[model samples]
Target chain A: EPEVTQTPSHQVTQMGQEVILRCVPISNHLYFYWYRQILGQKVEFLVSFYNNEISEKSEIFDDQFSVERPDGSNFTLKIRSTKLEDSAMYFCASSEAQLEAFFGQGTRLTVV
Target chain B: AQSVAQPEDQVNVAEGNPLTVKCTYSVSGNPYLFWYVQYPNRGLQFLLKYITGDNLVKGSYGFEAEFNKSQTSFHLKKPSALVSDSALYFCAVRDMQRGNKLVFGAGTILRVKS
Candidate 1:
């Protein structure tokens, strides 16, 4: 079965530095999303992308956060300047038609 | 706003015994309910969902959930628990009238012991 794939199982970045997380969604899916889970916290939605543009975003998704489908298969999330609170497990997901999604193993991002 | 609530932080069940994880949701319109499981160092795996059909929805790994519209609850159930079933479970909901973003509960840890 096809599943979303995220690069860099874990990442440690310095505070105030830029960080980029990459994901390869299922080949046939059209919609993609990025979510984060702080340690011992609930999974929180960051942003959703469809048709090469952001369809919707949560309040947590601010100016510092941006998502781009750089190519047909690769979706990327960039944080201009990382903060300590940004440390969390970032998950990438893809859906066929905005229905249930297939998730990646997740990239654990730790900002010091 | 749409939201999900999982009252229990943890549920312990013996192997071969039945288990149920409670979930309740609030949405303006009809809700699409889903149950997901997460193992250690893994992503959320789809278990089951309630779209628009029968109230009883069966999902992967011998898991099932009953959607109660009146009570605004969609609780996951398993006939016989297994040690492999020990994991963190999340309940999520999407408001049909709203957008597609799913609001998830805080999650409940299921511990099936021998």
Candidate 2:
């Protein structure tokens, strides 16, 4: 089966530095989403993107966070200034619609 | 508002025995429920979903879930568990009125012992 792919399985960055997490969703999927899981915590939604624009976002997705589908295949989440709290496993998911979303393995972000 | 509740934080069962992970949900409209499993250091894997069908839905890895509308529950079950089935399980619900966003439960850790 085709799967969503994420690059840089793990990342370590300085607290004030910028970080970008990349994902390549299933080729035929239309709706894309970003979610994060703090260690030993529930997974939280960050943002949902469709039609090349943000559909909805959670409070955690604030001014410092932005998502871009730079090309047809790559979707990227950029954090302008990383904070220690930003360290988490970021997951990328896609769906043909809503009820069936496929998830990527996730990018582990570590800030120090 | 929509939400999912996984009542158990952990469930322990022996290999070759039956196992169940309970899940209940609340939604304003028709519910699209799902079950997913996660191994350590991996992303969630889709198991099954209840859109609009018979109460019972069978999925990957010999897993099945029964959607009880009146009870507002979707409980995952396996006839004979295996040590390999040890993982974290999550239940999710999607409200049609809320679009495609899925509300997931905190997750349940299943440990299958020999």
Q: Who wins the DockQ comparison? A: 2
The candidates' interface RMSDs, in order, read: 1.7, 1.4
> Could you give the CAPRI-style class of model 2?
medium
What TM-score do all the candidates reach, one by one?
0.96, 0.97
Model 1 lDDT tens row, B10-100: 9999999999999999888778889999998899999999889899999999999999999999999999999999999999986443336
> In candidate 2, which residue ranges exceed 4 Å CA deviation?
none
Clashing pairs in 2: none
The TM-score of candidate 2 is 0.97
lDDT by residue for model 2 over B5-45, one digit each (tens)? Answer: 99999999999999999999998878889998999999989
lDDT of 2 by residue, A1-112 (tens): 8999998899999999999999999999998999999984688888888889988788899999999999999999999889999999999999988568999999999999
